[model samples]
Target chain A: MTVTKGDVERLIDASIGAAPAPTMDQVKEFVTKTLDYNFAMTLTEPFYIKPNAEILHAAGKKLCTVISYPLGSYTHEAKLAQLKQALADGADECDIAMDVSAFKSGQYDKVKEDLKPCVELMGDKVCKLLYFASLLTEDEQKRAIEMAIDLGFPMLKTNPGFGFSTTVDQVKLAHDFAGDKIGIMVSGGVRTKDDAIAFVEAGVSRIATSAAFQIMADFDK
Target chain B: MNKKELAKYIDQTDLTPGEPYDKITEFCKDAAENGFASVCILPTLVKTAAAALKGTDTKVCTVVSFPLGMDYPEIKEIETKEAIENGAEEIDMVMNVGALKGGDYDIVNDELARVSKACHDKGVLLKLIIETTLLTDEQIVKACELAEANGVDIVKTSTGFKKMLPRSTSVEDVQLIRAHIKPETGLKAAGGIRTTEDALKMIEAGATRIGASSGKDIVDGLAE
Candidate 1:
């Protein structure tokens, strides 16, 4: 398995486009640079999606926006609305935060009910169920992964990466449980090229990081 | 302010996503026992917090379009209504700060009016979090104007989760916002409010409420 820098780039999902408090000029500059780098996907919030969709499309990069991000506590209706709005705003893919609070509270039905419509709405679009595997107990993580699998999400992401770190073990857990039924994407704890390559080897479909460019640079060596 | 009075101004918040259930239950119990104004939590835990604080004076408050108010007004409205049904007595929603910063006042106003109406219809109070740390003095004033104009129950300073540096809500910010908004519009100072001293400064600066995760620490500091 010879993983080249180009291979790594193709699997990278860079979030630099969504950097905080960027002026429109700064956003354009950053997004242009990210698109030029040819990362498989560039993630931004819904507000920035419409403005940059043309450039993203021109550069042949996928636009990934978040729905109920970081906190999956939004009601089912709100999440669906967010999903619809994100797509309407020119999102090619979405990383939706799952209702970890409900699942952890032992409200499995509530969790499933909340996500069903969003998944259905996403249809063929890439819908990654973003859950905080690092914050949950091992059993809870397993249950969460299983629930995502049961719900038929196209992809599953581990943690949202603001002080929450994900491990290869978590990715492995999802990879094993999902068993080709769904793709696994890991966001947190990926700081360097080695970490990114390792996660991909461990069975991740994508590696999301603010360190995408640095990882790409490191991969050049 | 005395400990009792100060406690009433605090909305004990744990809006951290995926916070453990045991932690939330304990948080609810502590907030109830301490008699804080409300236990502010994520939407999923609204029902749990409501159940925990059922017999107590503390209410269950939840956030909508939180930390980032990027959703459409219709979406935030539905979220507010659902949160009320789940037992959230107060709703601290983040206005579309991006729109405000981008000078799209119409989107911001529409969101505020719709969410405010949704909450008021259910006798729930709406606290509009404008994320003051991300805005300029003018933007803050404009945000207050919009919040006040839409009949928002309260104008909150920040979500405390700004992606950039200096995430705290300064006393000056509260004062500036308070000066701009009407006296009838309640003011809440959230984000980076920790110690009892910080709470008192915000209160003196005309803040009617304090949104803090360290509600126990602030009250206990006063007791000590």
Candidate 2:
């Protein structure tokens, strides 16, 4: 099926992370071009463009800043501080990377505790939890989804674009685990319109990528 | 440098994606036994590495804005503080190479100063990774100068994450950094120093620290 512009726009979350810091002109260009779609800037180095959040928000764009991206290894306090800074800078959403290491070490409580503060801090703003699905076992991925759901996160994301791309099976697994209780966002390697459509067919609510503009442009053809 | 001496200069690292907890523990154990200078790990693993190396001289070193130096100065400061609280004795932060290349040296210097102050406040050594593989020689020299001026304790060569030029750690880069910095400033050669010969060449080129994942192999190769 040909993906519609509305469908692509609704499902796209243009992300800027895993690269060097873009200049202000680049940020402005991105904001202007992808105004119709959601934008996420990872809270890692380079994209800490919290200062530009106000401009993006004024443009009626939904700007999100991801915390402890690619590696949710920050201490609870650090993550909270990052979330607060992002919020103060005008971010409408906070996408937190789940403490996968803590979970893998069987420190489930620590993992939950790590997320609790950010969830509380976000308040009315949207909170999405990123679980590096490709790195976790099937059971672990399911449990992560459950925890995010229980925490009342608005969305659950797969991968931080650092590891493997989001697969159809992974998206389906998340959909099965979440069952519409929470939005499912698939990130990393959704490079084309076809890939995006396949994910949408798999029940993905959103797709986060650095290639959103390219994908959207490709879809118009 | 001999194997024993080389061990003292090594900051054994494993910043691999999806690195297991047990592997970090194992890295710490190996570092301690080998008399390595430090165990370089992710910020979250600092506490674990600290606990593992308790009473041992193997300091816990972690990265800030690691692999990519693009986070705001405030966020990097928070990361540095949290890392220190978790028992990180050394902080290896990637300098905002984008900012440097963009000619925003003020922002770059301010970031280094902020993180450096945080580390110095807790007596933690700070190493700034310049990602030399992605920079020209002039940019590399400028980065080292800025790092020294900003009070960074060590000037690191790369984060080992560069894929473009991918030169890793080289003797010429180490020599350039050593020549630019003060005598008191430390030079750390990281990225691709995978053999004993590479380690010795770095040391000979004036690197006081060598960051390598192949610490065991390099040391073993020394025996041969």
Candidate 3:
């Protein structure tokens, strides 16, 4: 296989994922090494926005979080409360799960109805609809993508690391169906450079993974 | 007479709990007397609101999940039934943004299908709120697509939560949906839409209905 420097570079970029908010020393080292990347950090218990803002600004990267995380089964009040906290913390965007159980049962209307309130609750914030399409078939994915587009999601993402890896065929499936209607984000198991560049080439607008640093590190080396 | 033309819009909130007895009845009466288009009430008080405003131009609207749009299909179906039974004229339901984000497309489809069926089965209209502020521009478009695909009667903006109301229903949100959905579908803009300028903006942006805690203010502002 002809592995050129560019291939390795893309691999490094895609590999950039999770990092323990290192001491100022480690952070300075990483920034000195790599520049082009999307870095992420989840809100640890008891989120404090100001400190995170300072930390992220120093790292020169955007911040994101999940609300009513894992499952979107929380009461409206509870989910809103979580979102309020995320926004107050200066999160660049949020990954909110659309209560999946209701959607699976073919209760389109009930699911349909909630779009507005959820969006309202997300007011003036970046809300990315986490499209965990792993459990769904291609056609089913299309329908889901259609509904998500109809509801007005800012970003349509796949996999939150809860299931199967984010694959090429799947990304292609979403990209094909989504067309220009929405932006596609691929998360879950994106730990190497080969995949990240391929995903970008495949029309993925963003890549969410914990390997952001390695992707960056591999570049410097 | 055209309902939309006969009178101006009114929100007639439904979050109020328990026996609306004196509360909703009196409120509906005042609205009807003032020539408002509708009295929106909780599904529980649809009958009461409708009854109180009997013989007037005012209509009745109810919400499926008042503040949040996350619930099982079975429960939402029942809520739809109850709201229709109680004489609701329109139904505003929240979409499962979490499910969509989670990539559970089937779940999102099934959930909305159930509620939309309930509303359509009873001839009551359905308004799907994407809650624009919560969604990214792309996600917003996808949400609109889903609402249109499921046969929802309208695609609305915001449920009174979101960072900043998108300068009145966001012509972009409206135009995006307008580009796809059949002409039968409509658009609604809620949240921070109080001033006449706000109302006009939504109208221009393609919102057919405007949901506001400031409905009275919007109407009065329009008069001004």
Order of quality (TM-score): 2, 1, 3
DockQ of 1: 0.53
- Tens digits of per-residue lDDT, candidate 3, A2-76, equal 444354343221221232212223333444344444443333211333355456667665556665444344334
Worst 10 residues of 2 chain A by lDDT: A39-48
lDDT against the true structure, each candidate: 0.83, 0.80, 0.62
Q: Write the per-residue lDDT of candidate 2 for residues A1-221, one digit (tens) a residue.
A: 76676786677777654344455555656666666554443222225455556566677666777788657766677777777877777777777988777788878788898898889898998888998898899999989999998888999889877546789999998888778899998888888888988898899888888777788788668
Better of 2 and 3 by TM-score: 2
Task: Tell me candidate 2's TM-score on chain B.
Answer: 0.96
B5-121: candidate 3 lDDT, tens digit per residue: 423644545443222256668878877766775676655456667789878877787776544454445555666677677677888887765555545567567868998898888
Write down the TM-score for model 3.
Answer: 0.48
Order the candidates by DockQ, highest first. 1, 2, 3
Q: Estimate the TM-score of every prediction.
A: 0.92, 0.92, 0.48
Instruction: For model 2, state the Cα shift of residue B133 in Å.
Output: 2.5
lDDT at A184 for candidate 1? Answer: 86
